[model samples]
Target: MSEVEVVVAHRERATLRVGDVFLKIDADPGRTDIEVEAMTLAPVPTPEVLWHRPPVLALAALPGTALGRLGEPSTASPAAWAAAGAAVRTLHDAPLPPWPGQSLDEVAARVDAECEWLVSNGVLPTDLVTRNRQIAEAALRPWTPVFTHGDLQITHIFVDGDEVTGVLDWSEAGRGDAHFDLATLTLGHEERLGDLLAGYRADVDLDVIRGWWSLRSLVVVRWLVTHGFDPFAPGCEVDVLKSRL
Candidate 1:
């Protein structure tokens, strides 16, 4: 058997590399989206219910940022934005049955709980939740719900030239409010968000999506400030998040 070594650890999962295959184990019980590299284009068996979401096996990995190869680094380009947009569109369109465990509210509550811990620990300024709740509630209004990537951000997309090859992470994939997904993207990269929206279905309200961005950014700032920038850590994401706030 090939040995594995931990490459990265997060709140919910740990990445282990064995030979050419990367094993992503969810910290939570009964969650599986493990990906194994396939060499040829062949039809694989339908994934068991244990497989969690259907993994994207063929998308080529891209290079740019250390976190994920998301579009053009720092500077925004049309081709890059379009690539990111197309990637997300593909990810969102992938055929997968509902996740077996964890409800959407549970996930939101998990985020809220993490924020609450930060507040209780005094890492986040007091009144952080109060202010954020108001913002999120206001932003969440005026949008219908759809299946979302849940943690969709520019950094999750892999881009090359004018084409998007893949979306890197899928641990947080679920059915939820699509606006929240758009919001998270817009909040982090406001300048390039318009380009992403352009690739999405035209019926979506950009204003509402922007509002979600504000709320999502607020939560992210609180999390990074309190937790010391673990997600996409060691990079300038913490600095960027702080700049937005």
Candidate 2:
């Protein structure tokens, strides 16, 4: 195997190339378990940066790296999306570990920590509390907890043709509301998003999915703040976030 290429790089996490092996280095002490656990939604092989005294994640590198893939939709919709939706749903429905020992408040607090980090990093707007409160009141309701792709989106749905080869970046997976995953796909591009959500709702509720959408927008805004408003990648999503926010 050849050394994997460091295709995507970030301030806190740096992807490495080590013979078809991608290692993610979390160079910051502010990392948390809530973030890294998000990657399990996909069945692909991933390695983590042991963030004790030194934290890092070593991910298995996938074949083929598209330099300009994010600029446009790589796969066509309908069939491609359908396949992707199924792949995610399968993960969402998988038998997950019970949370009998944990409290809901603890889980919510974890999310709050990430949200706070995002805000302080300039990845999220200063009005996070107000925005989150509104979303919580409107969208958070009775939900059968399942595996959520915390950051599911077209960008994260990696594919090899009509087949969803894999879902990338599981740094935010957990037994939470499934709407977050559905909203990540639908909220912005309602027409196309609706189709995707429709595909997802084959297993869950679409009406109560708005909270996830709002939360997804919050995440997108954070991406925009941390990353410059790139017209191609996050730019498209940001535009949708602005309209909805």
Which candidate leads the pack in TM-score? 2
- Tens-digit lDDT track for model 1 on 1-245? 87766666667566666654555556554334323211111122111122233321222234443223222344546766755655555444544434432354554575566567656876545565555544455454433434456666666554555555445554455555666666565544566666776676445666556445445654565555544444343323333334434
Candidate 2, 55-101: lDDT as tens digits:
66555544333111333544355666666566667777776533322
lDDT of 1: 0.49
Model 2: lowest-lDDT 10 consecutive positions:
62-71
TM-score of each: 0.63, 0.64
